[model samples]
Target: MSNYVIQADQQLLDALRAHYEGALSDRLPAGALFAVKRPDVVITAYRSGKVLFQGKAAEQEAAKWISGASASNETADHQPSALAAHQLGSLSAIGSDEVGTGDYFGPIVVAAAYVDRPHIAKIAALGVKDSKQLNDEAIKRIAPAIMETVPHAVTVLDNPQYNRWQRSGMPQTKMKALLHNRTLVKLVDAIAPAEPEAIIIDEFLKRDSYFRYLSDEDRIIRERVHCLPKAESVHVSVAAASIIARYVFLEEMEQLSRAVGLLLPKGAGAIVDEAAARIIRARGEEMLETCAKLHFANTKKALAIAKRRK
Candidate 1:
């Protein structure tokens, strides 16, 4: 079996725990070790934020944790031609995306953008692309321009609300559907010019499964919905939505850091545990309810550490 070592955080480890739960496992101070659902892969995570992957699918499996990619079913994408200023920007399309869903702290943010023929070329010219490919500083700089140019809406599910949702046993995909559908309707209404000819989604779940999750919602945009993986690679409207959603996520993170008087770091890991312990020691355990998603295993680890501090 091949062995590979790389970085891992608490949240990523938690994901691994969820993914490899049924397999034989061991949790220790050094890290967590488990056999993946596929017996072909065995992985170990370290408290130092490192992960070691061995077995056949090591690289592929490790990437999912590192990238925060959805573990849902994935299908091969028939790549669409790369969009140019004259081609894609010439259509009436609305695009949607979300940010901070994988984070241990902060709210889930969903954003949608409507771009008609007149403004598509403008956004394309601005070089707006996938938010994942761009850094937070880049997003901050580009987001204002999109806000001024596009008709859009952003919905935020802050920590308190997110905690409540989890407590009520809401599944992540269903929550995402609710947010995306809600944002799409609100943004479409905000456009006021015309109904978009099509709504494009940076597909997370399979198309049918995505819609199935929406059954719980009372109102959903009954528009022509087109779901594509990596839609932001060529769709300017989707890219615009991604930028703003990510920008807002960062801004909220900043606000959270300021409130807690510590750089509340992103991702779940050992450092996050330390930060949580700090928050608990300074503000008490209840304060974490406002700052973190209680569902995370990080909460338990941090709480345990907090008790030691007393």
Candidate 2:
């Protein structure tokens, strides 16, 4: 069997041991490279190709033989998952997420978080995950915590501005994709001095379409942008971004509601229609466009209902 040497931070090494010991994934992939946890030092190892052993016996054997005589203190800034995998050397990883896309009101906000070989656990422990899986209060509480742990950037596209752009001939989907890409670009630019190795985005479209759209804008992502579904669950940085985006959107919505003197509802559903109608009655139809995304079908419906009641 061929052997390979892999280096990793202590937490990742401990995670590797936990995975092999059935405390993590039940089936450890063959040829897995991982770190083993010791009191003051971490031991790194590689398993021979994708073989699933019956139990933890092989892991124990490998752990015992792989022990090195020299031990060093764990680096304070080492994060396991953010570390570049074996063949990649050291590289930075980033995660991106957006909010307010489906809402009839409020601005579309996209956020990106840069995570390196340190601070992954602190983010995960703060309950950062998919924003859809969280409530507004929870997101608000966790967003600042995530920001404290990692550097991030955001882009907000307010409704009136978005409508003006759309009326000028931008397709809704294209506009959204463009805004998301621009946000990504801004984040990349902000972190360019650091030169991260890769970036991850929650995939909004098929790969070819996304790449083509980005290419049209002359914003080539250099094949290092990974777009995957449910990425936030697998990547802590993306989860942190998701929380930030959601928190910002929630806050913006609240402010918009106060500005218009009516409770603005979430989403483009029937409840939102009711809220829009109430706002129009309390204020005026002309003011509705300012507080809501006029491009939504719900906007036309609300206008029609308002006219009928008048």
Candidate 3:
């Protein structure tokens, strides 16, 4: 797919809106004046006097309104870095994000989602946002909606597996990189024969470091991969992935809570330490291997708290 962005005056915006008025769609992106779907392109005009043309025939459609010299066609194949930096939201792409990494309990869940320009409105209508901005109930409600609307894949690294890998000298960042890669690969395969304009991963590490960690892995997917910080805000696909991953993380936490007969608190805070101590008392230290990332400082803190109570 191709993506092009052009600056348009109010007159041109009105003209374009009028031209595609019959094809207009609802649930426009925030600050968007109007959006329309055409056979060859999805056109979105924003309040900032910017018009985006995206899809296989984006260039052709954009050409109709602007001259060859005035048009700023930022095709993915021609200027990969520039395209990723500026117009990621305008392109049809796959985006991946992870959750539960900072939490002391539950597995780390990474999810990848594919979103084209055509589905942006639908995704936005699902109320997708950064998972951090939403609470558990909101995530639970929105996640399924996004799952139904987009092609997405999620990978969960349970506590036992996470602990095993951490003990084997693997860094948490490396584990995240692997999980992100796994979900991206799965989604790409799930949507086989239809390549996206790009693959965007919520930036956890520098681009070089991320791939360097995955260098030993077989079948790594690197083409069109852009690591951007705060990516969930850049594209609806990343936000959808974030919400889904967070929902799964919350569900897993519930299961672990039931298994331990105590609520597993989130984060590596004092509350988590208290909960961990309770788990140790009710079950044993080994129980955490199944439900909590043992390498976190909370482990030591919980142990100290448990010993003090005993």
Candidate 4:
């Protein structure tokens, strides 16, 4: 699919909005500019003059609004392998990515998926993009399809375990590398493909810093490791990993919410803090440890709120 991000004036944005007014559907809720959904494309327009166009006809659609076409298109490129993975002469690759590390209420989930050449078309047709752009329902729908066909492994660090790991003084980067490497290796071992071409990691750190995190660990597959940012846009495997990770994270959040009998919102925002405070008021601080990452600063605010209620 052809996609582009363009900076346009309000006039241009208004023009497009009016063009798609009736066909313009509400999708993602941004502050000012709404996501106007058309039959073939999804547009995220911001009042700040940033507009993103994504879908098969993204370029054509955006051309109707913008004067100059932005040449930056991620369609032809696959994640972690844009050039390096292709150099390997085959699309048989494993890509690793994670989700929910920044969330206040869910587990940190990492997933690795092996995308064989034969399944490339299949994966593309699944409309696998970065997990951030996808809604919970879309992710939940696509994840199982990827899981059923693609060889994959997912590792989840629940809140309690995440807190314990943090107390052990391991940085999140190191922990991510640990899980990503292990999951990729496990997926590779499970499939045991005939010399899979490349193994890519969604680069969380700089090229050197990422390796530095893995320097102490011998588990990393240094070979064919393409550490790329926003790899999900390019590599189906990374996108698949992102989706599956999100699905699992959402599932964990659902279970945690059920256990607490409250809706646990994502992110470390003020709203999340309010929810945390409510949880603590009902259950003791001990129960918060089970449902949330205790190391976050939100814990302190929730404790204060709990004390205030007392």
Superposing all C-alpha atoms, what RMSD in Å does each candidate have to the true structure? 15.2, 10.8, 11.1, 12.4
lDDT of 3 by residue, 196-294 (tens): 988988988766678889998887888878777788877889999999999888889899999999988888899999999988987999999999989
Candidates arranged by lDDT, highest first: 3, 4, 1, 2
What's the lDDT for all of these models? 0.76, 0.65, 0.85, 0.77
Superposed model 3: Cα runs more than 4 Å off: 1-79, 84-86
TM-scores of the candidates in the order shown: 0.70, 0.68, 0.74, 0.70
Which is the winner by TM-score between candidate 2 and candidate 4?
A: 4
* Comparison by lDDT, 1 against 4, better one: 4
Question: Which residue segments of model 4 deviate by more than 4 Å?
Answer: 1-90
Query: To one decimal, what is the Cα RMSD in angstroms of model 2 from the true structure?
Result: 10.8
Clashing pairs in 2: 13-35, 30-49, 30-50, 30-51, 31-49, 78-117, 79-117
Tens-digit lDDT string for candidate 2 (137-176): 8887888888777888888888788888878987666666
Off by over 4 Å in 1: 1-90
**Reference-based lDDT, residue 270, model 2:** 88
lDDT by residue for model 1 over 232-287, one digit each (tens)? 75368999999999999999999998888888888888998989998999988888
> Better model by TM-score, 3 or 4?
3
**What's the number of clashes in each of the models?**
3, 7, 0, 4
Q: What's the CA error at residue 256 for candidate 1, in Å? A: 1.8
Candidate 2: residue 157 lDDT (0-100): 88
Window of ten residues with lowest summed lDDT in model 3: 76-85
